[model samples]
Target chain A: MSQLKYALYTGCTARESTPELLSSTLAVAKKLGIELVLLDEASCCGASHLQDFDEFLAYVLNARNICYAEKHGLTMVTICNTCQINTAMTKHKLDHDAELRARVNEKLAEVGLEYKGTSEVKHFLYALVDDYGLEAISDKVTTPLSKYNIAPFYGCHNIRPSELQNESNGGENPYVPTSLDRLIEALEGNSVDYESKNKCCGFHVDLQAPETSNRLTGTALVDAIDNNADMVVTPCPLCHLNMDVKQHHAAKTMGRDVELPILHMPQMVGLALGCTEAELGLKHHVTKVAL
Target chain B: MSRKETHKKVTVKAFRFNAETDYLPYYKQYELEVGADDLVLDLLNQIKWEHDGSFSYRRSCRHGICGACGIKVNGKPVLACKQNAMELLELFNNELVFEPQSKKRAMKDMIIDKKDFWDKHEAVQPFVVADIEEHPEHETAMSIAQVENILDADYCIQCGSCHYACPALEVNEDYLGPAALTAAYRFTVDPRDEAGMERLELTAQMGSGVWDCVKCFECAQACPKEINPIEKITKLHNLQFEQKVARSNVATRHAEGFVHSIKKHGILDEGHLVAYSERAAVVKHIPEALAMFKKGKIVMPWNMPKSKNLDEIQKLVEISQTNKL
Candidate 1:
């Protein structure tokens, strides 16, 4: 078998906001013997603003990073779901959208960089499920989590329709796979399929209007809590941000404390890496959840 | 100082990547030792140095302030430095599946391209814009309270989590998004910025601007810095009252209907609320209304119940408005 490896693109959030996920993923990657290379000085993927308001600027920014990965002769692996969506979308746009590709190429030329759009952008979840396989995962099982029952919150961005993603594939059902369920099963935990897994976190509404986000999130959370989810796990930082930090406000609006603890998949994975509570920075949560 | 210590061998499943594929991906698992107080960051660092040096991830400050270390720790978004590995051991019984946040591009193990986040941040024109030029000898021009108003907006660390979590940004591809709107609000309340009117106009024009938001509060929640982009946007909406630029939009219509409904009755009147909001371009759908009535979803006069505390609700709004003025 060929030795599998990839170039790592830890998005800015993981670098500055959620270090535990980055560190934990690296730690686990090392133990798994996966050769991962770090992309230094990686530019932003034009996450929301550039892509939404200024596609040309977004293409320039995302293409530059693609150029970086191409120069290193490695594929790109992303940590943030949004970063994945944006980069993949940009790649899709660059490869298929000729006008956009040319414009972005011009912008990249300014920085002495260019993207061929050959390198593939993969989310860590897809890599884990496809490359490592459950058999390989099972071989490394040291501690069993048969007793844990978890409810996975997929959030909207990572698993929604292709139009919702950066890359819109006719073959891909954006709402198809429940990576969270598979992840829970891999960890030897019970995956409780709940109704709120694919629903929007009301994040956009929250940004534009509080009452709507609050009311909507309140309804969704109440259902999740009612479904008996021990903890709400998601792959997007914004999902965690909304589910955890805004929990108090949601509780306020609903007139009830739906204190569901939010966890990033990497932190949960880090726990299985034999890390302690303090090692994962659990104390920093807006709403404390007893692990 | 005695603390309960549980020593257990834990399993770690990590995602593997290659830059060459056009399709599906998978996982790799490993074994490690976990102790009390060990965080996810500590464990990864240990693995990187002791087991494999090729492991790559980004981290800074080791606290939640930097907003750089967002990843999926066992299927949830988190700051790795802020997460305790031991907590996962207890929460999930010591089994973990680690991956990067799903929607963004993966550079290697835990990183994604952030050029977009930074560019989007810069595109918002994040710097404070003031109307009046500074004079060395001039006394303080802005009020402390006005300065304080923009404080929350100023604290944004540009994590991009809000942008990542934003569904509108995912689909519309033109909205200014929470971070940009919040940035706009920062300038709107600057007390020195002459562009408040212009800024508001620009926001109104941007399809993905404040109007596009479905009000999910996801941005506010995802914000590691607790800037509450929602509140900032709300403040901007309040500024609309002062701007007097209300021609007719979804938000304005909703706000007006809500205010008028409450003013007329103690509580919201479904009939009047719908009728008033019908004036909005987005909400004008007679067929949808007919369908609601067909399905018996719309409540009739006697079938509909009013809020029991109507008087109290009316009194609150009246008092707040009087005091607000």
Candidate 2:
């Protein structure tokens, strides 16, 4: 197998909230003979505050991370969707808009940095298929996940077709082959038929208003469960965090009890890659997926 | 229905950029051989690891827990971990494209600022509001169910995907957005919270509060947690109704007009609707009103026609009232 090099930029959530995904993905990549390059000088990707308010501040903070990547002559590979969007969007803006570029450069100059706009923002999943190749990834799968009935949850950011992302595939395309989905299938896991696969999980909304999110999340999960999905699979930590931990909240608000296990793609891949449950971060989860 | 053959070779054309050299953004094409279940996140990782080391993007917990992976997969905001790759491979089929989420400053490729998203969330004082007298040196006895009831407010990952997809936030940045309001609702519904009234008052005071929502379901659709922010806004509106807060005069007027129309005509009377709405317009334009009347736009005034289901409507209202009681 030809070795591939990637500059891995694990966002804060992977570090603090879903570290298991990072550890497991790294482990799996190593087994596949892939070189995982850590961003030595990387800071926060600045995905958290950019969409809320103060676009300029978001630019400044994210630009710092981008400049670091540029200095290393490496592209970014992120594990979180928000970080990917924020970084990709920032790169898009800095590269496309001249006035904005000039302004951001002036700001970067204050911090002893310059924004020339050249690095490519790529998600880890994209890197997996585009670089390592799924066939290559499949060759390394030692164990099949045929026992697990997995239902994939495609959160809003990664697959959304928006003006910012400039996706050729319009939003709401159900046929797109996401890496997590392919991974599950490759492992012989049961990928159930579910509507609203690409729908929002209401994580951000839940923070501000619980009652509203309860109804929506409740409805979505109920639908997924009703469709006979044994477990909910996702690649984003926030989705896993909210679905696993907040599921009780959703069930409580709706006056019922339902337990759905949330797993990161890497954990699932790790399990399929013959990694033990301990190696996959299964123990760290609030709700354990019975592998 | 006929059977469709699934293709293995999926072409992805992703949007590429950085803050260091590209004057104009372009698309980079990669042919990925994927199974029926691969997600886009896996493909991006493959590309970054092998094809290009300079690809810049952000992600964590490739399972949608942190909301850090939000991006435009097709045009909608989605988490990379939650998405399937074959879905895109077939849809665009050798022409899949991706870009960053809109309305934010990009850092390199996909990373944007996240501080403001948290700031907006924090601005709401997102926590349980307890105004009840505290037990001296003791904790209140609450069941797991009770605690669970209000835990939805605690699920916010602050991914900003909802905020990015929020149309109201797109137009009005001052709006608290869905995630923040969901946080507020967490406290409002808490039985242990004694300061619900205070929180409600504060939320009701903002211009972009509950009243600003046009009832667009975008935020709800954008939420990875399935938190229906629009429903939360409606609940806040109900709270306003209970508190008798008239901050949403337009909403109030619309509701009253609706109620009055239903009350009088056994159905909505477009004529009376116009007259009631005149309260907001301040002046009734006789000519425009007449024109509408002539055009049969005023359903109530003309008593144009009753639905064949009038009894059903009345029965439904009665059932609603009974359920409320």
Candidate 3:
């Protein structure tokens, strides 16, 4: 397998709240012979919050982060769906709008930075599936997880709004996303088909309307459990937090007793690659991965 | 090979409902033999004409115009006229699940009551309201750029597909949905219109305005005409901030808090974001915050261990602000 290097932008959630995600991601990448260079100096991708406030600030902040990856001559990969979508959308906007690019570059010049739009923003799953082919990943799996039945939860932002779709993997079908399923299969796990597989995990609205968020999260979890998924795995930290950390609250709010283990995508891959639960940070999860 | 031999079988699972007869909605699956070149609308037409005459649905200009054949194909909002039947068969594994546009009251099979959608659109006053006296020639004198802006907004077919696909409207019925807000943005940016501030205020009214959107981007995907409603909503947010509109809304607070936190620490500090954005509401959640802190879900003084590139980020923000003016 050829070596792959990427400037990994671990968004705020992974940096502060989900440290295990970062550790697992690093461990999995190293095991697969992929070099994930951390963009330590990079700030937040200015998420949707920044975009809602000031479009220019959001553009500038993302452009600056892209510039850091470009400086290292590497494409940027993000674990958090919010960061992936935000940075990818910004890059798309800058790429299509030269006038905006010129304006962004003018601001960037003040900080001795310039986004030439050379670097592309990719989700970590996209990197794993597309950059590192499925065959390569399957070959590296030392502990085949054939006994496990995993349901892949693709959070909303990673593949929607049309423009931010990952082009490398048949783009995003929204209704029937196979990227996560392919990854699960590569780990020798059965990708269980379930209703509400593509539904939003309600991570975005968790703050504004907790009840509504819980209801949405509860619906998907219930569907997964009913379909007999051993556990759920997601490519996003926010989704992991919602499906794992908040599962108890969601179940309580919905008047049900639902305990479903949720794993970040890297952690699942780490486990299948023979990494211990501690090494994969599975113990940090609120819902225990009994398997 | 003969054309008959090339045909394929497809199963359509459609939602069936009747306000007069049915007590509850249910799904009815229909099997059909369709040609490769057939559109979903054609398949529906064949089903009604050849298989089941009682199976009712709506369709008009079947060439992707008119926007009449909007329905969910396998849980995705798409124009039946625009979707190739063979491709959909391949995509959904020879079976398609159809339902009337979601978040809408179904009158019958594949038809929804769109009165709520029209009412929301009218709430925004989606018309060019000129401050000056109205004249026929005045409308004709718009520049090419001004005409383009009006045309972009006019692209909406009132299909309600976007309205149905929206998660916000699913939860909050009164939310000024993607289609309505896109129309609101249309009038707001019209060069000849004088109701820019008025329309913005209308959308900002009630808690379900532009701010209510979770930025899910489903509406943009649902639109068959490629009209990006979420982008329009974001532009409306920009207009709200640029015009110095209402400051008390949670959306405004969140935006302001997000920008302030990023400028200060070069990253988002959730504690600061909640404190700054929620203000007094933050006090109400002291117990929750403490619990999170105990569980190590959050770090207090969230803006600690500041970014090394803080100075550079500040410079970028400062320069961008001046450029904005």
Candidate 4:
């Protein structure tokens, strides 16, 4: 096995809104012998909201985060899909456009920081499946979840718009992705095939149009339930919040009696690795998981 | 030559509605034995030609161009000519649900009124305004990098996928949809165009402008040409800031508050964000903020814990702000 080290960037959601995801990710990475060096000085990734308002600020903020990882001589790893895409998109833009790169670097020079474009931004899912191959992961599974039917939801940002994807980062086929499903199979679980598997959880519109969000969320959950999935595991914290926390709201809005448990990808891996429910934050989920 | 040997039976559920005849819009299923290489457009054409002449859909070029055949296949915006029927069948378990783009008034089967879409497009003035002194013979040379910047924006086919998938448009019809705003950005950055600032001014309005986008990214996904309209819109926002156009909107204030809170606390202070972003209207949100506090969604700014690395974050923020253009 190669020596693994990463400057872990826990975005606003994992750091503030859902610390359980952060804890479980740390616990799982440790178990897998991957070193996660925390970049405590990092601020928000300027999120999707900030990008809408000021794209330059978003680029500058993300470049700052990337600069932190480059300074430490480690690649950046993000647990949140939004953070991964924002940082990766900024990296792609800066790398391709020299003028933008020069401008961003000029701003960074004031802070004694420079992005040499050395570090790579990767989602935790890509790291687990690509860096730590499925075969290596299967070898470490002592508590194989043979009975559980898991629905692997690859939320939109993590995979789509193939321009952001690369070979090492799951090299996702934006239309039909199966890397998440493959990871679930490695954990000795059934990856339930269902409609709306690649659908949006509608987390973005939650504040503006709650009903639209609910309908979108409800459709995915209903599909998972119809296919008899024990739980829906996702790589995105926002998706987990919508599918797990606001599921009952979605169900009420859609007038359905659906109850499907949602798990962060790391939590599912931790559970199959014999980690306790409490340690994995299984108890924190609104939709109860029996395991 | 046998019917069973060449094609597989695929179920297509197409949206059917005629306002003059039907009271409500509904789906009508059709089972067609489609060839392996057949596109979704081919399937639609086959149905309309052989199976049912009454089935209505818009299509000019059988290929991916023209952009006239945009529809929702399994609730995702896609061009019918670009999507392979067999691949879609396998993905959707041999069943496909086709709907005319949502948020548009359905005219008939798989056809929706694009008048509003065209109106939004026209609002952006999607054309370059040439300088009167510049003659056609005196062509201005552009760098390779300059062309690459506007390349993606030029790939838009006016398919209405981005427009239909936009959450902002669903909420506020006035919001300039992704495609039009992308067009606005394309011309704004074009070296040959003389009306860059004018274009920015037109798109910087409070309601139906660049700031209205919610940044959902559905437009990027829905775009069959991979134009990534959201990225183009991001560039437009950057241009708006650089031009100092519409600097005092809630969106701009929200961004300022977001950065300020992050620098001060190393994490987002939601209370500060709402208060600062809302400005004088902060008083109006007092009841809402109290309700949120009661619900445990937020902590008061004074009571919030300072992040461990607030000092370092503040330095970075200070440098970035001081060096801002």
Model number with the top DockQ = 3
Question: Candidate 2 residues A173-277, lDDT tens each?
Answer: 333536566767777788876664665566544433445555556656777787787888776776776677567777777576678787787787777788866
In lDDT terms, which candidate is top? 3
Worst 10 residues of 3 chain A by lDDT: A161-170
Q: Which prediction has more favorable DockQ, 3 or 4?
A: 3
Clashes of each: 128, 179, 0, 0
Please give each candidate's TM-score: 0.51, 0.51, 0.94, 0.79
Relative to the true structure, how large is the alpha-carbon lDDT of every model? 0.62, 0.62, 0.80, 0.78
Candidate 4 residues A27-125, lDDT tens each?
999898899998877778776766655566668888888888998989899998878888898999899889989988888776677889999889988
| Candidate 2 Cα outliers beyond 4 Å, as residue runs | A48-51, A166-179, B1-325
Candidate 3, residue B248: Cα displacement in angstroms equals 2.8
Candidate 1 residue B30 C-alpha distance from true site, Å: 2.7
**Highest-scoring model, TM-score:** 3
Reference contacts recovered by each candidate, as fractions? 0.07, 0.01, 0.49, 0.27
TM-score: model 2 vs. ground truth: 0.51
Shift in Å, residue B119, candidate 1: 3.2
Residue-level lDDT tens digits of model 4 in B209-251: 7666655577888898888888887777667766777467556
Model 1 regions more than 4 Å off: A1-195, A198-291, B1-8, B20-23, B131-135, B138-142, B280-284, B301-319, B322-325
Deviation from native of the Cα of residue B244 in model 3, angstroms: 1.1
Which lDDT tens digits does candidate 3 get at residues B137-232? 545466787776554667888888899988777777778899999999988888877899998887776456887776778888889888889888
Listing candidates in order, what is each one's chain A TM-score?
Answer: 0.89, 0.90, 0.96, 0.97
| Tens-digit lDDT string for candidate 1 (B1-325) | 2336656677787765544552544676778887787778877777678776766677898977787777666555556777778776665556787776643477777777766666656665666665454665675477787887786788876666677666566555666778878888887777766667877776766354566676444575566576768657656655655566544644455455545544443233444554664454335445544443442334454543333334433443343331110
After superposition, candidate 3 runs with Cα above 4 Å error: A166-170, B1-6, B131-140, B144-151, B322-325
